[model samples]
Target: MSDTTGGLLTIAALIILLAAVHKPFGDYMAHVFTSAKHWRVEKRIYRVLGVNADSEQSARSYTVSVLGFSLISIVVLFLILVGQKALPFDRGLPGMPWDMSLNTAVSFVTNTNWQSYSGESTLGFAAQAGGLVIQNFLSAAVGIAVAIALVRGFVRSRSGELGNFWVDLVRGTIRILLPLSFVAAILLVSQGVIQNFGDHTVHALTGGTQVIPGGPVASQESIKELGTNGGGFFNGNSSHPFENGTPFSNLIELFLLLVIPVSLTRTLGTMVGSRKQGYAILGAMTFMFGAALAVVTWAEAGMHSQAAQLAGGSMEGKETQFGSWASSLFATATTGTSTGAINSAHDSLSPTGGGTVLVNMMLGEVAPGGVGAGIYGILVMAVVTVFIAGLMVGRTPEILGKKIGTKEMTYVALYTLSVPAIILVGIGLAIALHGTPGYMNNPGSHGFSEVVYAFTSAANNNGSAFAGITVTSHFFQISLAAAMLLGRFIPIALVLGLAGSLAKQGKVPVTAGTLPTHTPLFASLLVGVILLVTGLTFFPALALGPLAEALS
Candidate 1:
């Protein structure tokens, strides 16, 4: 009926749908990873890759496999992108420049689809489907594999082995992502998402001509959201009618981006034999997500600025089809998770609203982050929280019966610092260079925010941009690519190393002094740890940017 009613319905339906599927989908994923028997097709894939399906890997071996696989994927995809002009379904597009190709390759391979160019104008079907879309599935599977490996570390005792990386990757793709994406693609196409091989021209009633771009959008759109990979088939991303189509499809996309990450909490509980522990993590995520949504909705709807008042709301960059409330909901979902699919322009959000989303990313997107990334990210925080609590109580911290000793805390510390380090260092370098100012659309505090948002998005592997800065220069392309790669692999290596160390330890017995991490108290502490860490590290930088703009 009304936008407000539709927005409320959309929010209610999303929560209900996610809750309904949480257990079944999560348990299905658990079964997919842990089952002993493999499909004939999976076995064939193992043979092709020369992987020993029955064998397991220690954390070191698993980390090496992950790094090696991602490196190779980046190179292959880079070549494919640079050579796209000669590929089938070229669509008369030229090959991407070498730097942009490298950036795009790193972006997709890292599951951060940060685009500096318009997708329809820059990439052909061959590059879109064969390179970007394929990497979308593989990269997301890699993240799932890593998260499960970490889970195995918690589940096992006195063992160095996590699991077979190859098995996890293939099974995640074939058994989970593939089937889900197939169904989602059909649904999106039915909702008017384009799925074709060619573009055509059309004439307007005013006698002007327009070229409508078309591709296998529905297919790519499904995995892009389902996998939490945010590369859009169009420059307008989910805001484009052909990609998102309608309010119903927009709601579906939001649900798709969130479902896996939310369900993975259930998967964690199911696998670890502790649903309450999973609920603790889920509760922390839900609280932060709800808080961000509220702040953003209030800020946008209030329209506090003089210009915003004249427009009636913060409606400048939002689509008419989805009003301020719906757009704010989408913004919250996209930023809260690492989905990065936007139904509205984040750059035009009220200063307070924009700041909230920025902080959401700065909190490492653990308000239910990317597919495999969120579970592990929050789990790392959990370990840190436990360690802090243990120190306060003058007892050694243990979670799920595993001791958070020196080695584990070291890995946790590195994991905690890695993304922030990348973001800060990258931003410093970008701002120090005189050429950076040329890229900004504004020249004051708002301009500073654009720079912070770019590196923040890149380093966190969340691909959404503030849209007020141009990042197509060779400097931006290469540097942001480096940030994406380092931000992604460093933490992954540390996570796997932590999993290995934890798996090597024998479980400690819980005693009267032991802290229960699955309670509301623990969830609150976890949330506090997230906020404390992010605020401490990024508050100064934020004060100079969105904080300054919002106040002014």
Candidate 2:
């Protein structure tokens, strides 16, 4: 098959596999969250934590629980990394620097996984498995818990409670993420992704010797992609052959990135009592994802850079061990979701190609966004779309039988506008501190794009970078940490509140003037709504960066 055909086929087959498992997986998720009975093991953990599994909490309480758990996690994890020299399996790596350790702690716990330090050299196997790996499961569980809480808001009426946060978190991890990750890890190991913790091995050669580092990689690799927490065990990320050993390993990682995020649409649909509602959201996400893939794939195929012009593509920084087709595919999948495990350096991508990645993240990563994040983020957009369309058609905006009122719209407005505010302001701060902390390797429009992409990645919690900027200074470590926290928890808190408001609301009967949100027309409008917000917010900065370079 042609390379283009192969790339397209890979995406198609991946989507098909997702669809094949969607109903079963999604339904299982719903059951896990909503079932009355808990497993004996889960019951034991709940008792130990002093959790009341039977009593659901209000949105405020749930939010607090999430925050409290995360804060404790951050402190605990920070200590683990900072004192790793004194811990077991130190592997001769000492304690990390305080600021970098804090940043790493906050990043992983928040599900951003934006590494300011290389994992292989900085973190030992014990820290990776105990601290980072465990957070991989918990952070993702937190996301699913929030999404399930929001779903409960729509599915339950006259009920002020969302759900028991402890229950949801436990069930999501044990029942959902753990099993899937076990299987994915095995597959990765079978394909030669490293699974052991043996130390560095030196192979003697005729002239010299080569040192190879090894750790418990495949276990961490599975959840890193599956949970949409894209921190790599190695600095090369998926590009490292040891992490992604073959073309099939590349495909496996790509599929893992997309599987949960996409199936989440079905999970949303199943929970809300209308499968069509979920399909509408899924349709909008798919359309946007496909559009992004097309642009990036096309742009990569074009010869925009001097080297690319000669080589017929920008092969630099790409995983040539596979092919450009696979790298392009990985780029599309990585950016489309908040998963930032790259098989290629996005900095070397053509202007349009890299800009597409920026645009995808700037749109709040809702093109089948991060694990539990995708469904809730797009649902908020749907609410905004319904409200606008309702205003235009001169009627009430109702979705899944709930009225979109001032309270609902208020939460939606806060959730939608907050990220851009964080992005624009964070960019301003970084640029003000430029020439030092925000140093860029490239100059002109391309350099500007690097700064823009970093804050965009942080504020949207995507965690991928253009890789041309120097961001290891105090300013970036602190500012980007702040961005990742707000970008993640703030919207989640608001979403739960909106869910709370919607849950307390009475289901209004469908009137003749109600906008049909499940139809293709509404799906189109939903896409428009998403673009409208992202475009209006980021267009000026984007134009100044990537667009300027492309035009010049």
Candidate 3:
């Protein structure tokens, strides 16, 4: 098939498969967190963890549990990493350095999965499969729990209790994430992703001997994308042959990363008792996803870079087995879903393609966001959209039959402002750090883009680095760790708070004055609001970085 045709088919197939499972998966998730019935295994696990599964919690209580659990998880993982060399099972690898361990622990637990250090050489099997993989499941489960809590806010009234955090967390992992990941893992293994705990296999080449790495990659790979945690087992990430051996592997990885985030829209629609409203959000997400893919494809095809000019295409940093079409698709999908698993080097993307990735993260990643993150992120933006429209029409802001008041708006305001605040501050600080030796590999406007992109990825909880910027220092470690943690849980806290306030109000009767959030017009409005807000927020940075590089 032709390049463009192949690209269209790859992307189209993903959307189609997602459509097939959206209702079933979404409904299953809805049933999971809300069901009164508990599995016998769930009961046992809860007892073991000292969790009272039946006890409901206020939003504050729920938030506390999330924070407490995450904090503890971070500490546990850090201990595992820092003490790896002495551990019984992880016998060979050296313990992680202090700051890297802390940063990595925070990264995985927050669902950011940002890796400053390569996984192949640095971490042992115990830390990789046991510690990091555990967080992959837990962190994703935590995200969905928060999203469902927000849904509860819209659906329930006159209730302070959202749900039990432990119950929600357990149900999400056991009921939804684990099952899906299990099946995806098997599929990946069959398609040549490794599933072992052995040492690297050695082979002799014409020039010299080569040592190929092996691990429990298929199982971790499945959840890495499926959970929207993008930490790679190898330094080359998905671009590495062993991590993703073939075009088919690339295709399936793309599907896995996007499936949950895309379907969560349907889950939202189902839980809120309005599938149309879910469709409205999906419509907005699809628009942005499609637009990014198209522009990226065009940019890659244009081969705008000096390197691309020599290579005769956008093949400089892309995996040739997947080709430019697949590379562009992967770029858009990874950025679009908060899945930072790169099949190619994002830093090598032509100026336009790389900037689009930045723009995707900057847009709050709401277009089919990372697992639960995308749904709530977009929904919060929806609140902003309706509020703006309400002002223009001089009507009370109401969504899903509830009045959006000052209290709800305040939560939305905080949620909206948190990301840009973190990103801009981190960028300024990173630029200052630029004067240090080895801080940047590329100097000039493109170098500035690398700094901006690093903070953008961290603050947005996107783990994909733009490369060419050294982030191994104490400054980047602490600062980026802070950005990932705050960027993740702070918005989650605000969403839960909004959910709490929204839960307390009784649903209003629909009227002529009520804004039609389910309609196409509202979907368009949501998209417009997101674009306008992100454009205004990040435009200056863009002009100075990618845009400047492109113009030059």
- Top-TM-score candidate index: 1
Best by lDDT: 1
Give a tens-digit lDDT track for model 1, residues 248-283.
898889999999999999999999999999999999
Cα lDDT for residue 180, model 2?
88
Residues forming the 10-long window of minimal summed lDDT in candidate 3: 429-438
**After aligning candidate 1 to the native by TM-score, how far in Å is the CA of 514 from where it should be?**
0.9
Model 1: colliding residue pairs: none
Q: Rate the local accuracy (lDDT) of all candidates.
A: 0.92, 0.87, 0.89
The order by descending lDDT is: 1, 3, 2
> Rank by TM-score, descending?
1, 3, 2
Error of 1 at 196 (Å): 0.5
Clashes of 2: 0
| Candidate 3 residue runs with Cα over 4 Å from true position | 88-91, 434-437
